[model samples]
Target: MFKLTLMPQNLEVHLPANSSLTELEFELHGQESISFGCRSGACGACVIEVMSGAEALGARAPCERNFLASLGFDGEQFRLACQCRLAGNAVVSAVAAPR
Candidate 1:
């Protein structure tokens, strides 16, 4: 399993390896620490910062890369939660940029 720590609020959620954020909608969405929109890469509302263990989230796909770039977010740490999955443990902070 992996531990995903949502920052500022410091909430911790556990997931088995290779889990997607979309799979956690029920466990997460209502939390004020983060926000989700569309649950797809098109909207930037799911933007999150990998506060630690960034490699755990792996790489971004072409569309996600493009969209994040368009939103002025660059680097591996910033990810669209909807577009990412957890491979290992990760700590993230919601930095939502709603569409």
Candidate 2:
């Protein structure tokens, strides 16, 4: 399982391998100020900043790349939480971008 740690609040959420980032976000819902929309990775509303353990998440998908491009998010540190699949273990922080 992977661990998602929210910064400042220090909240932690565990996600199993093969678990989608959308599922993890749901699991962590209501715990913090995180928000999600268009769970299919087209809205880019669930973008997050990988604080550490990026290796735990699966590689970026084509849809995710397109969405990020549409949102003008070119930084390598950003990821769409809905499109990422847990591969191992990771600690992530919510970016709280506009929907």
Best model per lDDT: 1
Every candidate's lDDT: 0.81, 0.73
Cα lDDT of model 2 overall? 0.73
Per-residue C-alpha lDDT of model 1 across residues 31-83, encoded as one tens digit per residue: 67566778878878889888898888878888888888888887777899987
Off-target runs (Cα >4 Å) in candidate 2 are: none
Best by TM-score: 1
Q: List the candidate 1 regions with Cα displacement exceeding 4 Å.
A: none
Clash number for candidate 1: 0
CA lDDT of 99 in candidate 2?
36
**Compared to the true structure, candidate 1 yields what TM-score?**
0.87
Task: List model 2 lDDT by residue over 1-99, tens digit each.
Answer: 667676767877787778886675468656663567887776767888887878777778776776776787766778888777778767777776643
Q: In model 1, what lDDT does residue 36 have?
A: 71
